[model samples]
Target: MRSYSSYVLIAVATLLVTCHALHKCPGIPGIPGLPGRDGLKGQIHLPGLLGPPGSLIGRPGRHGLPWLQGLPDSLDTERHDVLVNLKHRLSRLEGVLALNGKIREVGDKILASNGREVDFASALQSCEEAGGTIATPKNEEENKAILGIVKQYNRYAYLGIKEGQTSGQFMYINGTPLNYTKWHQYEPNGKGMEKCVEMYTDGSWNDKKCNVNRLTICEF
Candidate 1:
């Protein structure tokens, strides 16, 4: 009986030690679970209270640059008046130039196309004063040009042709032989009486008294 009792005691002690070791040992890790469906959206938060009113609305910012100085009103007015006067002066100058241009045009036309009428002696003197001579046509072109001026007057005009040293022969004022003649029919009838020649409105040459007043052309 005593030996059976000892065997039972030993079996109980061994079983208790085995139970204590199992309680202290680590266990195998388990696999993680699948991700859960997205949680319901979080609630929205309300805006925070407004900050205290900013620094009692600070003083206005300073100007970046100084204001520009300006001319006095009186000086500005004076300058404006001076500009107006200058414009008027310029306009007057333009008008004077226009008048001068007109006068020059008329003078050129007269010099090219016509001459004034005067006594034969005055005509000769005028030609001399103007640095020209009494016109003497030496060819058909010159005759026609002189005749154009004489026809405008529609009257007798003095020519430079006159009796030469030989009584009946005619010559130019400059002593050139009168190579061209346009005498009218039945003209030069005065043998030694007529000393000068004149052109009629018809452009024909005729003997005339030297002192006669007539239109004249000066040639340069």
Candidate 2:
């Protein structure tokens, strides 16, 4: 009971001191405080979150083919793995290196047709896909055979050699009569300049500046 009374006395003493200090507080005439500078403008950016920038093709409408969902703006947010994978697929596009060191681009259909050494059948199909035509000449007499072949497929075409500079030594395309260049002095004669052009079956070319009227292997 005595401890409780002592605590009450201490609390009364603290209140008395606070009251005395408030009473003694003077009427201080106010001095002006420094005015705060106006707050800086917030960033002047647009309010709403923005979408990805338009592509060169712009955003595609819904025709129901492959469509790009908008890409992420942040570089860190983009899926780099997908782009890497697409690049890899592009590099692996199926194609064949021709005997002439030219490229014969093809699709999966070409790979399916199996043949000995090379796949001419599949290559022909690929050529058609590429808007080119094909032909087969049995012998030297069949140089005109390409006309029928071209008429059958695209109006324009290129002849593929069965062997390098061996089978008939030439072929034809549309109608323009091209050939392996077999050039010599004063060739394709009978006139002042009736030059004859020739091509080996191996894609090699020659021209004769004389009157020897050799058959041509044309490409339109």
Candidate 3:
């Protein structure tokens, strides 16, 4: 009986070896296991580049302080007295200037003449050299004053009025518009041709050629 059992076990072992050599006895597959946990987070290498600068500006500064004190009362009184004294001195000086036959005072204006006849250009130069300008009347009183000088010289005198850019439009040498005028009847007919103005013996104004000889009357 022992020999028989031993022979059967040897037969079984030989069969298992033959199956493995022929690769015919593969094991049965098992069921899959559960999923694994997530891995650790990655480490940062370097920080991101710096952001651009801000565009906002600063606020405005505060206002300055006000003035402290006022002027003294005695200063006001002194100013008034000084102005009165200056006006009196000016009146005396005007009187002295009028005492001479060459200077005539009408109102606050002083009209004078070199009593010489010259063209309009020469008259302007002569008056400017004397620290005065050609006589320009702003009113009838001033006009009469200039007319007196013209009558005294017994010749026509060039006034400070002239034709402007437009014909028949007159202005002062300083480019101010005419505030007063004494245009004679049917006068200023030359239009653009007669640029200079002259005072007649009758104390009226007429537009005349600049080259004409006229008395050099100046005003201060």
Candidate 4:
């Protein structure tokens, strides 16, 4: 019984010692786990503030193509020229109308169809002012036409025909020969030193003084 008691005491001491050693020892480190699987990607961030102004600027864009040319006007250059010429002719016609009391156009010739009575010298001046000469008949038809125009006033009219260098011989004011004449019987007998010619209402002509006043005629 004493031996049994001794064994029990020894076992108890051994158990106590083992329990104390276990309590004092440090714990073993565990193996690091594989890095945790990457978490879901985060949201995108906002843009940063603008940087400082640049030193150099880009070149200007090419100038826009020149504006398309406008279409030409209805009156082209040639038509414009014609219009200007017509305007000039109209202005001239207006001037002619103002100068002559009445005018008649006879196949490219403009004549004073009607005129007031004035002295021969004054009549010549008026004709010159109107850019014409005294009435000068070129043929029998023209003489008849002139007589018809002047006879309406029922008066003798001075003619452009006058005595040439030779007395009693007549010629036109333009120095042309007077190839035609219709004289009343026994008239123009070189009476009173007559130098100019006058046409009667009856279409006859006679020598007369230049100072005589009568209805006038002008031709151009």
Q: Which candidate achieves the best lDDT against the true structure?
A: 3
lDDT of 1 by residue, 1-220 (tens): 4485565555445434554566532223335445578644433222222212221222322432222234466766899999999999967875674455311112222222235667768888887787777777776667676776677667678888888767677888878788889999988876767878988877889988787778867766
Per-residue alpha-carbon lDDT of model 3 for 1-220, expressed as tens digits? 4585565566445545655677654334334444557543433122222111221122221332221233356665889999999999988887786776668988877889988899999999999998989999999999998988888778999999999999999999999999999999998999699999999999999999999999999987
Cand. 1 TM to true fold: 0.48
* Candidate closer to the true structure by TM-score (higher is better), 2 or 4: 4
lDDT of 4 by residue, 125-220 (tens): 888888888887767677776786676677889888888778777888878887888877887787448888888888888888898888888888
TM-score of each: 0.48, 0.21, 0.58, 0.54
Clashing pairs in 1: none
Clashing pairs in 4: none
- What's the TM for model 4? 0.54
Q: Which stretches of candidate 4 lie over 4 Å from their true place?
A: 1-101
Which residue segments of model 3 deviate by more than 4 Å?
Answer: 1-97
Error of 2 at 68 (Å): 20
* Span of 10 residues, lowest total lDDT, candidate 1: 102-111
Tens digits of per-residue lDDT for model 2, 87-193 = 87755653232322222223211212111112334445555565543433333334333433333332332334322133233224333333442323443232423
Predict model 2's lDDT versus the native. Answer: 0.35
**Model 2 off-target regions past 4 Å?**
1-71, 74-79, 95-199, 206-220
Taken over the whole model, the C-alpha lDDT of each candidate is 0.64, 0.35, 0.79, 0.68
Error at 157, model 3, angstroms: 0.5
